[model samples]
Target: MPVESSALPPADTVSVAGLIDNIRGRDHRQSRLAWEIYTDIERIHALTLDRPPELDTRVFDHFANSSALLGAVNHIDKSHADALVNEALALVHRIPLTGLCLYDGIINQRQFQLLVSVTDLVDGWPSAPDVDKQIAKDLQDNGPGSTRRLRDLTKRAIFAHDPDAVRRRAEQARARRTATVRPRPDGMAHLGITAPAEDAQLAMAAVEALIAAAICPHDPRKKNARRSDAAMNTLQGIPLVCQCGREDCTATPRGAGMSDLHARIVVHVICQDGTLGGDSHDGGGPDEGGPQDSPDGGPGSEDPGGDGSDDGPGDDGPSDDGPHNSGPECGGDAERPGFLDGYGVITADHVRAIAQRPDAIIRPLNPKPGQALPTHQPGDPYRFSAALDTFIRARDGYCVFAGCNKPAWACDLDHVDEFNHDDPAAGGQTSAGGANAKCRYHHLIKTFGEWLDDQFVDADGRTRVTVTSPDGVTIEGRGHTNEMLFPALRTVRFQKPPPRGPTTPAADDPNNGSGPRRTRTRTADKHARRRRERELNRRFRELHDFGPPPDDRR
Candidate 1:
């Protein structure tokens, strides 16, 4: 029998046309604002256009650097202001098609900026115009879903139109690989190594393997902290030893000796959990923790716990020494991409190639369909289980905050619905379905700033998020899942465990259906400070008559 009309849920009455119009209207306003900013920058540029380099005049010095003046006006860094001017001018002049798209509201400012960046190398190439036209047409036809997709589309257009230019740029970039150290605050420094994509991934994999082998799972240090220490140890010929202090710790490296001199290296190459057909566990080989030569080429051999055994079946055969598989069987979903952890997405071919390396070790992380991953129910600890934590990090590749792209691994797993510390059984279980990756800043804002974040799984199983600002402006986003990179994750589902006890009475609960206590949000504080600063600056401008008549040193 058909359900009664009133009993049924109300149909979605939102108008698609109205939404599109609203978006277009906003885009147009933003485009106009960008143009206004560009004009202001141009006027500033004109002031110093033909100034003499040898001029010692105070007036000339003050007007010479447009970026400095603009920075002062905007209360921003000079370098940042310079970059903004350059970007604005480039959009208007170099890539006019993209600029037109911006004007027509076909693409937003961020997308335009991304296009400008990708097309930078091919600016003077022969097919640059064609590339621009293609990008504009593609965006007009089917706009990218996200900035990541926009970047992917822009890069594809560049590769298609200017293949030679792309090749030349890649070659040039490869030749320029180097390592550098920059001093940081508080007696710290940043060490960066620029290398080929494959090399970087491999190096990271090696470091990860060292961490895995040297430290126990119960180690006090976080993965990131351990990674830093492991990298340092590897670089300095020191042992990546366990600091857990447990006498029976399974980690091999106890102290600096023969074993310490020769630590095993196991490079983990993640692929799809199983065969392309998804029916069998015929992917990923056994972990091969083979003894690797020390940084000083010193030779030492000891079984680092891994005895090469057939952990599973795949196209590759069991090899006691190294991987024998040429590559993964290519067809259907087998060609799905994989990510390089700290790096960006890599193709299936790259994944297969890395897996087939002589020194590589394949560790399969299988995602079983319809299986319930670890979840915190009532009476259980509030913290998410290790398995659930890993899944959440992988599922939400980055922070769920609207514009933040901070990697999920580095973010705090925040409960979208405030977890009831007073009464856990009432609601907000520490489960995969209830949690979202939020960077510290956004987390703090969500807690203190009257910001509301709602996360739900749609009918199609996509994780949808809506973040509402204090003023009621809502921004919609979706989790950047690993399903694209690791196809096996597509089948994985999170079923929120049911509450273990009787629900708490709405009246009795301290939250009373409301979120955290509202406070003067940091964002509001920053805006208020900026407004006061701007007002003061304006008043000073009126009183001082243009900054002490421009440094009177002649």
Candidate 2:
């Protein structure tokens, strides 16, 4: 009923490039090919595991060397390779081929199949040769005849299998996996539960427990009781109570008392709508047996909620004993004598001139009463001002640490010399001198860690600062400073200027005619005379026909 392959067109007749092009075009075709190869490897892995105890190493070696099998199939990209390898390895470990053949004595069939699949996927037939050699060497060193008894034991363990025993052992493993407890937002603990499959009853129980643990309030019609108590009643005889106090307080309250109290406190503190706990007034109970009256009558009151006038004093206004001052009125010479006296009233235009005037001197608002002025003043006030300006400009660079990019303007000017007398020698530099801009954190690290040993010295031999590492390494000196720490005014690489236009040649014979081309003078005139004397000896030898020089001399 079916057509014979001999009657059909040969696959070789189709171009290999065309075949590849066809495969590339269809996503499903590529995926199917990859999965087919993966499934084959999985089957091969299982057969290797099911073999007799003594045959595992030989079987595994064959799988590992099967590079031809792996490379023959396509879809060897990162994602496909990873997924296939992972799935195969998972099965191998589950059956535990590696454990039985190497370290652990027990093995599961499922685990063996998985491992074989992974090994085949990773190492194809061509790659298998190297794996074979390695395995053979390991067997030679650690097989039955090895000097180490433990090595032999390990070898036996890697090949052994026990399907039922493994399954039983996995029970404890599953428990350990599920034992982890995650913390709830309300500070309660919850155990994670994972089953072979989802069970509705179990899931519902977990949900019910969570709901019970949560402090949901009861309906107002039900006297605003705890939801835990209501949930307990819903689940009859399922106790939900404070679980505290002396022996006899077993009456379940539906939810945990502690959780309820905590939830109540949180609601009271964080409720933006101002609805939880109670109304704004103290005496507003839930059931008062009458329609509640609004605080400002039935919605349309002329009182405008409190008081109508915007500026007028209300219930919360200042009392007589408050900071109310009834003082004399302003603008009168008699009532407030010196209100306008001695006050200079200058117009806005005059401000600039007053500020720029050479004779302008502004006194300090709160100068020390008896403090004496400095006896030895350094230059004029303007010179001092200029020095300050220069100091600010020079120190405009950011915190001077490699990779630290803090701006200098944003930092504090730290004194290298401490101002306090008690720790005079503490900060390194002398008193009343030396300061550098540093951020608050860096300043603390420098000061407390006593890292002033690290410093940058300027050309004048003045120590700028030092930042020493905790490891006792000193980072100091001038040119070695990190440029990243300082603000870069310009980059270091040089740029060449653009070429100029060609100059026009001067017109020939237009003026006094072309001048003679200048010749370069030689500096070896004396040397030339010495060279001529040397050449005379050679000329004389040629004229006299002197005998040939001795062989050794020649």
Candidate 3:
């Protein structure tokens, strides 16, 4: 049934059903409007269909199409309108299925944009139609669910159908890596580095470590402020000093020792053993035969960060067991791709290239029927074991919260069920099955808010999660787990560790004793600021605005 605007009550008075109806109505309208715009552009394009197919002619045609809509759109610049028109043309002509999906209300504007952007390189290939069809089917059957998931799906489709194009794009992107600085509205500037994912991750980790070591926890500066200060100090090759007033602060760097900045970059790349030798498909086909050399010949290229040596402190130098073929043990074919922790899916050839690096450490994760993995249960150690921690991080891949893409390596390992400190025997066990990676913000919400999350292994061996909001609304997802991308993860499972012997709680433990008191509660500060804002808003509303300055009024 068509939605009627008259049927929906006012925002405050609308029922749940009414609100849902109103949302769907707006969605349908948006889709219809997009279709109409696409058709309009098509008509404009038809007017010059007979023109020569030269690059300059195409540019001229685009300008003509955009010029026709100069004064048509309201409250938008001509340049912005022109970009929109060009995008519409690309959608309808290049990736036809995505445009059709948008017209059918299967995806929203953001989702459409992501699909177009990710598939931009693949759309010119012969296999582009297959990629488009598969994406449309995935979107229609399962729904993109979130923009993050949509991007992953689109990239995966492009890669699966056209690996060469994906590799070409990656090489081109790698060549364009550069650092930039931009001015902001406030008296601040934005510093950006367009480096490779691994390089950026390492640089970020080093900066954060410096910031933490430079000041005591009691420093008054906010996190962002401290980050800026630390970054500037490091860039200028200066030693960072403690900002705390106390002269005896432990975090204070005594000498130029703070100038020595280094981070142990451990990029967790999960993949099958076969992937390390190059893609399985590379054995056969014309273009796909054998491992292709990287743009800089091999992994030994003069890449600034790719020195192929793990010299940083506390770095684990590969596994003891070493590289072993885990195909049969992991229950997957040989063509599976690899997943970089912060980066998304990478090709099998790319994985092999990483493996060829002298610093690369390849460890096979083989799951035997009764193999014992590390686990923490009950009592003394509340932390998951190092091996178990690594497994869980690789499994979940990112924050389990819907739509969040924060990589697992940077996230905290959160227990799905809260652990009981007072009585450890009765609490949630810290094991692979019960633990997941959650970014700090979402972890705090799950701990304090009325949100509830339940995780369970599906019959197909994939981990599934369902999150319920305070209002009782629920959403189910695969928790953005990489087990889907790497099938080997699915085969690995840890038996719940045996309960540990109970031990007396330490006197200094925060949960056992009264924790260090805060100067002011977060809730109190929030309420105070909001109350002042309300008062100011009321005062501003009561005072009438003068029409303009005296000269302008004339």
* Ten-residue region with minimum lDDT total, candidate 1: 308-317
**Weakest 10 consecutive residues, lDDT, candidate 3?**
305-314
- TM-score, structure 1 vs. true: 0.48
**lDDT (0-100) at residue 308 of candidate 1?**
11
| Local error of candidate 3 at residue 297 (angstroms) | 34
CA error at residue 513 for candidate 2, angstroms: 99
Q: lDDT per residue, candidate 2, 446-540, as tens digits?
A: 55554442333343333333344645443332221112111110111111212333545545454556775322223123223323433453354
lDDT of 2: 0.30
TM-score of each: 0.48, 0.18, 0.69
Which one wins by TM-score: 2 or 3? 3
Highest TM-score: which candidate? 3
**Model 1 alpha-carbon drift over 4 Å, by segment:** 1-101, 104-111, 119-193, 197-331, 356-361, 367-370, 376-381, 422-425, 458-461, 478-490, 499-554
RMSD in angstroms, candidate 3? Answer: 14.6
Taking every candidate in turn, the Cα RMSD to the unseen true structure, in Å, is 18.1, 38.5, 14.6
**Scored by CA lDDT, what does every candidate get?**
0.54, 0.30, 0.58
Deviation of model 1 at 157, angstroms: 8.5
